[model samples]
Target: MRKLDEAHLCESVGDSTSTYFMKDQKSVTGLYTERQKNHFLVHSVACLGTEMHLAACPLEFNKGNATASCPGGVLPAVVSCIPGPLYTHSLALKKKLKTTTSVRLKGGTHQGEGRVEVLRGSEWGTVCDDRWNLQAASVVCRELGFGSAKEALTGARMGQGVGPIHMNEVQCSGQERSIWNCRFKNITSEDCQHTEDASVRCNTPYMGFHKMVRITGGRSQYEGRVEVLSLDVNRTQRWGLLCGEGWSTREAMVVCRQLGLGYANHGLQETWYWDGSNVTDMAWSGVKCVGDELALSQCQRHKVFSCQKTATRFAAGVICSETASDLVLNAPLVQQTVYIEDRPLHMLYCAAEEDCLSKSAAKANWPYGHRRLLRFSSEIRNIGRADFKPKAGRHSWVWHACHGHYHSMDIFTHYDLLSLNGSKVAEGHKASFCLEDSECQDGVAKRYECANFGDQGITVGCWDLYRHDIDCQWVDITDVKPGNYIFQVVINPNFEVAESDFTNNAMKCNCKYDGHRIWLHNCHIGDAFSEEAERKFEKYPGQLNNQITRK
Candidate 1:
C-alpha cells in the first residue's frame, strides 16, 4: 500500500449529507479506544436513557490491519478533527481597517470624526466614536489587533460605503491619510461617495501564487488522453520537437544547426501501434519498453542519449498491453495503453514542453497557488442603488448603493492547454469566470456581455474576466485543463466595466463616468504599480473581509 502524497489531493467530505452516506473510515467520526471495560457503563448514555441494542450500532474497525482495545477501543462520541495544535477559535475584536492619508472626504461630514463597523457576534455593526480622538483611534487599532494606532480617518465610509455614515468630530495623533485622520467629523451622508463617506481600507502586503514542482525526472511519465482531429480516429500525429542547443549529447550551442543533430523542422516522430502488437514504452523509438514477467521479458531498452522526433505511426501491439495504474496510463480501451516511466528528468518551461518527443504526450495546466490579500487605494464616486426588481428572465437589477465594478489581470490556465493558433476567448472566459465568480449565481454580470467574455475556439484575453466579488473557491475545477497557457490578456479594468457587468448597463447608456479610461490607454496592465497590484490580487479574499497575509 502506497502512502498518500501531497499531490494526492483530496477534498473533505465537507457536508453532513456526504458524511451520512459515506463509510466511517472516509472520515474520523468519533475517537475510538483500544478496549471497553464496562460495556453497560460505556454503552449506557445518560444511564437509563441508553438504547439497549448495543450490538446494532455501526461500531466496527474501519480498515484492515488496525485495531482498538476493548473499553479503550470503544469509539468516542465525537470526531478528533484536530489538524495541528488543538487551538480553539475565539472571538477577537480589532480595528485595523484604515484608509490611506492622501485623499479626503469630498462633502458632508456631520457625524463624529468617522464611522466604523465592528464584528459583534456574527454581524458587522457600526461603532460610535464618542471620545473621537487619538484615544478612539487607538481603541479601533487595538480592537483590530494590527498594532498601536497608526492613524484614524474621518468622513467617508471605508468598505462598500453603504448603510449610513455615523461618528462626528474625531482627531488622532495617527499620521495623515490614515484611519486616524480626524478626531471629529464635520461631514455627513446617508450614503455618499468614497471621498465623502469612508472607504475603510487597510494596507495588506503583497503575496503571489506560484506552482510547486517537486518531482523532476528525465524518464517520461505516461498519461493517456483522447485527441480529436479533422477526423475522429487518425491514429497518426506528426511530431517535431528538438531539445534546445546545450540539451543534447553535445556541449553548448545556440541554434540547432550549431549542433550535429539531424532533422530540424521534423524534430522527432514516434509511432505507437494501438493494435496490441507493438504499443509498449520499451518499444518506442526513443525509449525502452516494459513487459510482464521480468525474467522472461524480451523488451529491448533504448537509451534516449539526445534526440528528437521525426515522424511516427500509432499502432497497437499485444492483445492486452502491460499498463500502469488508473491515474496515468488508463487508455480508452485498456488495450490502447501507452508506456511512459517516471525516471528523474528536468521539466521544460511551457514554450519547450509543448513539443514533447512522445507523440502520446498531452499537457495539463499547472495549479496556481493561492492568492494574497491587498487593499485597492482608490478614489470612488457616489452612485445610487439600482432599484433591482427581478425581470422576465432569471436576471435582476443589482442595486449597488455605491458599487464601481472593476476588473483584474484575470489569468486562466487549462488542465490541457488550449490550442494557441485557434482557441476562443469564450472558453477561456468561462474558465476564468468559473474560477473567479465570487457571486456564485447562475448568471453573474449578464453572462459575459462584454466583447471579451471569451469566445469559443478562439484565444482568450483579459477583457473576458468577470468581476468576481470575494474569496473564490476553485473547489472542483473540472473546468480546468492542466497544461501550457493558451496565451494571456489584460483588459483595462475601468473601461471594461459596462461590458463585463450584466446586471449593470450604464443606466443612461454611456460610459463617460468611467473615470480611469484616460489613464489606461489599452487594457494592458498599465503602470508598474498597477502591474504589481494585479499580481497580488488573489482569487480568494479573507473570511471576514479582513486583510490577506503579506508575503
Candidate 2:
C-alpha cells in the first residue's frame, strides 16, 4: 500500500510486469517510501492509473471556476487511486408520462413519518428517509409496500435521494423526516405527548370508512305545485321523485375531524333542485350556511347559521345547499369503504328496502365512452372537481348518475293524496325526489338542492371486512395529500330502530289559477327521520338502487 524505490520493489517482486512500480517517486507522499505497492497486473495498473489521473487532474490543474483546463501528460508511473476532483454534479433519470403513473409527493400521518418519491418525466426514483422513525411512519410504509402495518424500524439511509423536499428548517423527532412531515407544528423535541402530527403530499389510498347515515325529511316548502315523495329519502339510493308535490327544509352535515375538509352537507338547499325537474319552490328561503357567520345569514336559512370559533371561512355552521342553483352542486359526490353484513333486504311491502328497484340507470354509453378508455380519461377529473373533487383513490371514479322518474300535474293530485284515507293515489302529477313519499321535512326542504353535481357512485359493499357496517364513501385516495389526510365516517351512536310515517317531500309554487301551498313528506336522512319516525316508508318503498338503507 506504500511507495518504494522502483529498482528494489520491481526486482524483489520478480515480475516487474505484474508490479506497478511508480516511475515518479514524488507521487507517494503520505505513506512510508520503503513500502511496497500492490497491483494485479501491468495492464490493470495502467487502467487504474488512467482513472486516478482523471479524478485528480482537475484538483491539480483546473483554474478556479474557469474552463481553461488542459489535457494531462501521461507517464509510465501508473497512478494508484487518484484523489477525487474538486466537485461533481449528481445525475437523475427522467422519462415519459403514462396513465396510472403517480408519485408520492408527501405522506406521513398519525404520529407516522412519510417520504416523497419522484417519477422523473418517466424514470422512477427512491429517497433517503434518514430521519424516519416508527412513531410517525405507518402511512409511508403502507404506501411503499414496505411493511403491512408499520412496526418499529431502524437504519440509516442506504439509498440516493431525488428532487427536493424543502426540509431545511425542519427537525426530525428521532423518528423519520421531521415532526413537520406528519403536518404537525414545530414543538419542543423532548416534551411532547405521544399523539403527534405531520404533513405529507400525494398518495392517499382507499382504506376504510368511518361512518354513514340515512337522512330523513324536509324542513320547509312552497305552494300551488304538487309535492311528491320518493320511496325512501334516507336510503342513498331511491332518488328524488320530483319537487312539484312539496318542499322541505333542513340540512345535514357529516364530519370527519381528521380530514379538515371532508364532510357532507347533504340535503343541502342547492341539491334539492339540481335535477332538471321544475321545483315548486326553494324551501330553504332563509337558511344560513352552518360555518360562516356571513354566509349563515346569506343561504336562505330561516335563521342565521353560526360558525364554530375554530373555523372561520367555513360556516362551521354553514354548508352549501342545492335548492335552486346549478347542477354543479350535484356533480361533487362522495366515496367511501364499508362492510355490508347482508345485501339490503326488506320484510314489509311499505317501500322498506327492495321496493325501489328502479334506480337511476347508468348513462347510455357512447361510442367513445368505453369503461377502460374512460378509466384513463379526465372525465372523472372534470366530474369530480365539479362534484367536489371528492377523495380520489382505487375503486374511485366519477360516475355521472341520477335517479327517480318525474311526474308533473295539478294540485288536485296532491290534494287528493292528503285527503284520501288509505287512497294515497293522486289525480295529477307531482314534483319531488320521489313521488310515493311526498312528506318533505322543513329542514330537508332547505337542504334538498339540485345542483350541477348529480348523483355520483360512492363506496359501496364491503360486507367482507365489517359486518352491519356499510359505507364506501371513505375510499377516496385522491386529494388525500399524504400528510394527515384523514379517513372518517360518522355513525349513529344510538342503535335504536327508527319508525316513521312522514313523507320527505316539500316545495314552493306560484301558479295563476291556484296560489302556492307548501307540502311536506317523510323519509330518512333528516331531522324528522329519527327513531320516532313512525311508518313513513311503510307506504313508501326503497331499494339498493338508492345506495342506502330503509326509512
Candidate 3:
C-alpha cells in the first residue's frame, strides 16, 4: 500500500472515478481519506465496488515515475468508508422509522435486548446462534429503530424460545439495511434448538429524558414522588410535583420507561409517605397515556394544569425496578387437584384460628356443623429474571402461633370465583407464611428454604407449592349456589413485589358446580391467548381484573 500525494490527493481521491473505489451499497455516500505508513502509489484504479479482487479493477502501478511515486512527506491512502445512515446520531434515526420486515425481538426484560425471531410466512422462528456476531446484531438493531448493537448474545441469554430455527451462520458487512440482507445459511432440524437461539443487546441513544424528571423521597431511588421540570412565572427552571389525579399504572409505565427504570411496580395515587422533597406545587395535570410512550411528555396531558388535589401528599408517585419476578400458576396441576371438601367444626379449630374460613363461618354451630371448602393445589413458579421475594425483610415478619410459621407478605395470592360479568362471587387470600422453593428445574439448585428460619423466596426457575390439604389454601363456598363460574388465581395480587412482567401472573379456569359436585376445565394462563382470543374466551363484556394496563 502506498500514500497519495498531499498536493494532488484532493483532486485525485474524490474525483468522479472515485465512485468505483467506494462501496456503493446504497448507504455509501462517498470516500473519506486518511494518512497511513509504508506508502505505494497507484494511478487510474477503478474498483466499481463489486470487484471480487483488487486485481479485477483496472490499475497502473507507478514503478519509476517520480511524480506518481511517493515522496518522503507523502503518506499511503486509507479510507474509512462510513455509511450514509450512520453519519447522523440516533436522534436522526428516530426521525424515520425503519421497517423491520420480518425480524422481531422477544423475551427481553428491557427494550433493546431480546432473543431474535423472524417471521417466515405465518410462522415465527428463532435464529441459530452459529457464527452470530456484533455486525449481524448491529444490522438487527438499526433495523428495529435503535442504535448499533452493544452485544451479540448467544445461547439464549435473553431466554429460550419455542419454534423452528430460521437462519444460521449469518454474515454481515455491518452496513446492511436488515438482517435478511446479510448472507445466512438455511437451518436444519439437527442444526439448532431454542436453547441455541441468538440474542442482541443494542446501544440506545442517550435522550437525557431522565434529567427532565426525577423521583424524590422514598427509601431508594426507585420509589419517590414524581416531579417534573417546569418554568415558573419568572421563567426560572424549577422542579414541581406532578398531579396525582387520575394517574394510574399506564402513566407510571411511561415515567418508568423515561427514567430508564425497568418497569413500574406501583403507580401510587398519593405519595404523602415520601416527604423527601420540598417541592409542593402541582405543576402538571390531566396526564394520560396509552402506556407505550418513551417519555411522559409524549403522553396526552392538559393544556392548562388543573389539579383537584393540590396538597403535596396528593402528588403522583411511582415505584420502579430494573428486574422483577413473574409468578405463573401451574394451571394443569390446579385442574388435576381441585376438589370440594366438607369439614366438621371439630377439625375447623385450626382453620378458624387462622381465619381461613368465610365470614359466615363465624356464626356456624361450634364443633357440630360442617363448612364446605373449595380446595386446590397451587404451584406458583417464578419465571422471571429475579427471585420472587417479600417486600418486607425477615425482621418484620410476623409470627403465627397456629401455623407455627412467620408470615412475610400480608397477602401473596388471591383465589376468587367470579360470575360471567366479572363480579366476584367468593374470595380467598393466602398470606405468605412460607415462601420458599419447593421445587426447581433440573440442574438448578434451590436457593430458598423455609426450614430453620432460613431466607424465604421463590428463586428463578423454582416454584413454591401450597398443597390443597394446607390449612388456609381453600376458599369457603358453603353459602354459594351451584352455577358456572370463573375460578381465577392471581399471584402477587397487590403488586407487593416487583416483576419483569405482571401480565402472566394470573391463571383462570372455567368451573361448573352442581349441588353435590364441582367440575373445573380449560385452565390456562391469563395471557395464554391473543387479545381477540381472550375476548372470545371470557365472553362477558367486562374488564378482567388480572390484566395490566399496556399500550
Candidate number achieving the greatest lDDT relative to the actual structure: 3
**TM-score, model 1 to reference:** 0.18
Which candidate has the highest TM-score of all? 3
Instruction: Look at candidate 2 and tell me the lDDT of residue 194.
Output: 16
lDDT of model 3, residue 2 = 34
TM-score of each: 0.18, 0.17, 0.65
Give the per-residue lDDT digits (tens) of candidate 3, residues 267-367.
Answer: 88888788867787878999998766667877888889899889998999998877656687888899999999998889889778777788898998898
RMSD versus native structure for model 3? 9.5
Q: Which lDDT value does model 3 have at 479?
A: 87
**What does the lDDT read for residue 458 in candidate 1?**
11
Off by over 4 Å in 2: 1-251, 254-262, 268-285, 290-551
lDDT of 2 by residue, 128-240 (tens): 33344443343343333222222422221111122122222223332232223444332232422211222233222222222221122223211111122223435533322
Candidate 2, position 187, lDDT: 29
lDDT of 1 by residue, 218-318 (tens): 12211111111111135543222222221211110101111111111111122232221221221122322221111101223233434343222321111
- After the best TM-score superposition of candidate 3, give how far the Cα of residue 248 lies from its true spot, in angstroms: 8.5
